[model samples]
Target: MWDLLDPYSYEFFVKGVVAATLAGALCGLVGVFIVLRGMSYIGHGLSHAIFGGFAACSVVGANYYVGAGAWGLGSALAINAISRSRRIGADAAIGVVTTASFALGVAMISIWGSRGASFDAALFGSILGISPTDLWVLTGVTVFTVGVVVLRYRALLFTTFDPEVAGASGVKVARTDALLMLVLSLSILTTLNVIGVTLVAATLVIPAVVARMLTNSFAHMLVLSTAIGATCGFVGMNLSYHLDVPSGTTIVLTGAAVFLLVLAGTGGRRLSRTARSAPAPVRPEETVSLP
Candidate 1:
């Protein structure tokens, strides 16, 4: 027990733990909406799309988050705009725009290779390298996300689940959607330093999926997903330290393991319920033929 707790005495480990937990909670919270809206692909797409901004920022010597946020928000709005055409599906729009953005980022990196800029930190993350500034940014973003969700709970919920009905009920579905996208973009930006762009989507998705499998209640799902995400962060950080592996990969794998466990547990329960509710086979007398 002392051995396990010993890591907490180190400042870097402590920062990593705090950063991971906050990132997990934020991702879990916003992820509920992403999963519920059938927009899981957007999480992956937007993360990749931000790489273009990251590369551009590196070339220009600007703040990485600002560039990435601008790119992410722009890509998200573009996806929304393309998806609104009705001729294209949301997933298709996301795929088209995000892939192009990612390709552009790659090209920029290739062109700027002589500048000595490295994207490894953005691509794979360095959780132990988290700074005080990063923590402050994470805290602010997390608070903003939670506040928006709490204040506009009903409006966001109605719009997400039933856009037509919500619009008819005077819910301003378009504005709500834009706001959600903005929040999602910010959320993705926050996780870039903790999990990197490659694994950030997994952080945004897996915990929410696990919670969804365990409950039908939306409110309960949010709480459960947040808890599961925080747990994964805490446990995965420790595991990475002990195992000398990548923190981002370990955290994502932790969430995946939890998802599988919850899936199997829920599946077993469903099967049991089916078996219990099934009607017994009828005898010949009970199965009279129709006239």
Candidate 2:
């Protein structure tokens, strides 16, 4: 078994391991907010927007991460601005931004001539192709994300749970939301190299969603989500190597399996609780105040 794994062992494999773990951990950390604030679609939009950056960088022979990060940040800012409008709606805003950004990226690629390889690996992650430079960039993103989330945890939490109250308490809810969105954008950018724009949401949403099913506290949910994400990355990479499959798809499948298992474990119990609670809610006055 060890010798079989030896063929998979190399500098590239090491880089892949490091990149995936860091990306997973960072996504899990930021995903807590994504889940709480209903910003999962924001991850989706930002991922596509970052892909635009990647395309432009590829055309100009620049570093892809830098380009992707820039576009991701831009996407975050766009989402923040649009979502502030009461008319657009958050989900609608994300859809508009993602579609426009993606179209722009595709147009850029078309104008530069169809060099498919750069975008191909980006669309479907190639863990085996992750370079040392990419690993370093990913590590830096991880550190930055961790630091920001830690520093602003309380404020972010307050905003997520009760933005009106947080604003009344003098917390700048709009600013914090924008900042968090920016962090989420970077995270989405980082994971894009591993899972592509289309599938990055799986990494951001699956582990966090599963973690939520397992735990109620935000901190515990963060920890659990990170573990699940890293495990999915590792397992999916290995499975892809062994089975000659796409790493991104395998990783997503692994996450989905975990999500299903968590659902199976707790789904019935939660439903039972909901069913049982109905009887207690029959008292009109009590029911009115209960909510």
Candidate 3:
């Protein structure tokens, strides 16, 4: 309806819509792998870790994306490396590293009194606050993520389902994990502007989980999750402007609503198995059980 489209008469709304859509889609795409690998905590933790960088950069007058991106990447790698020790589990590593980073941010905020960027905005979100630079950064990250998935589909898929098998088949699990963490770090950096650090994990998680309930095929899930996320972003942005709600809150609520609808429609019966147990060659040289 024209009522819905009227907001675009303002250029800010237009940019908000685009940014939200791309941010949501990127989170959904990466979330599929994160969910399959049981790395849901990583999403939550990395967002918190990025917050530390956000606060530090804001205080120092540095480029937020660059500094925050590096900090997040380091946190992710540290978690991955610590988990690999077999001494500490991934969950513990996430809890320790990210929480420490988050604590650092809190300390900085208390000390600096929220200097450069709006502390409230970083914690929450403001779609109207989006700039041309933010949009371009978001677009670039989305393109890069898509490229990584497309070009390295087999390895990523394998890594998600069965890293042990993947490693046995010369898949280089460590490198794949590092690359994924890199993508995730950048995505989180871009996503923070649209949805805020608080809600990034939900944006990353909800769409992928919803898609999983709809289908067992990994490829189908990817497509469906991306579509769902984009839909939520578009619809939520419009609703937020009309309702005067925070754009990030509205977007996540929209995804949650979609989740409930799918949950009810599916009757919660699709609680099926993952591809970890069964061994099937999806293609020659790829011994992944593509669920």
Candidate 4:
């Protein structure tokens, strides 16, 4: 047992575990809205878009968080703006913008030799390299995300399920969407170091998907998803140390395993139609706030 748990003796391992845990929970928290809104692609797209910014920041000698954070926020807003247009679908907008940003990053890597961003580490993640500042920032982002969700619960739920009614109910649908995008962009930025650019979406998606399998209520799904994400992070970090695999890969694999187990155990019966990813109708009369 001492040998099995030997990695915990190191301080870096402890910090990495904590950072991954927070990132996982944070991703799960915002992922629900993303999923319910059929915006899961945004998580994948924004992370890639931010990678482009990360590469640019490295070239310009800017701080990763500041430059990449702003870039991601801009990309997210752009996606929202483009998607708002009637002609362009949200998926199309995400594809065009994020793919272009990713391609730019690739081109820069080809031209500038990956600069300071370290392509491999950025793509696959470098959990062990998490600094104290990054951990603190992740913690702050988590708290901020929770506050946003709590404060904007009614608005978020209403906008997520029925934007037409949400707007009618004085929820400010457009503003709510932009704010959720802001929080999502921030979550992806902070989690990038822990889960890497490539697998960050999986972290965002898997926990929420699993939670949905277990519950029908949006409120319950949110809480269960957060717990699953944190558990995956904690377990996956431990598995990464023992198996000598990438932390992001291990974390995603952990979630995937849970997803499979749940699917098998429940035999697809646990998921009610209402609990599925498609937004269930929320009539004005049923818009009473949930605790």
RMSD of 4: 2.5
Candidate 4: stretches off by over 4 Å: 114-117, 269-291
Write the number of the candidate with greater TM-score, choosing between 1 and 3.
3
Q: What is the C-alpha lDDT profile of model 4 across 1-291, one tens digit per residue?
A: 897789888988999999989998999889888877767787888889988998887777778889899999999898877767788687887898898998898787778765465677678877666889989999999999999999888778888877876787677888998999899999998987788899999999889888877776788989999999999999998888898888899999999999999989987766453244435556544533222
Question: Which residues of candidate 1, in runs, are more than 4 Å off?
Answer: 114-118, 268-291
Ranking by lDDT: 3, 4, 1, 2
Worst 10 residues of 4 by lDDT: 282-291
Candidate no. 4 TM-score: 0.93
Candidate numbers, best TM-score first, in rank order: 3, 4, 1, 2
Give each model's whole-structure lDDT: 0.79, 0.73, 0.84, 0.84
Candidate 3 weakest ten by summed lDDT: 281-290
Give the lDDT of residue 172 in candidate 2. 91
lDDT of 2 by residue, 1-291 (tens): 795577455777767766777777777778767776666777777788777787778777776666667777877888877766787577877787788878888888888854433576688888765877777877887888888877887777677666776788788988998888778877777776677778888788888888777765567877888888888888877777777776788888988998778779888464232111111212211212111
Error of 4 at 103 (Å): 1.4
**Model 2 residue 196 lDDT score:** 71
lDDT score at residue 37, model 3, on the 0-100 scale = 75
C-alpha lDDT of candidate 4 relative to the true structure: 0.84
Residue pairs with backbone atoms closer than 3 Å in model 2 (clashes): none
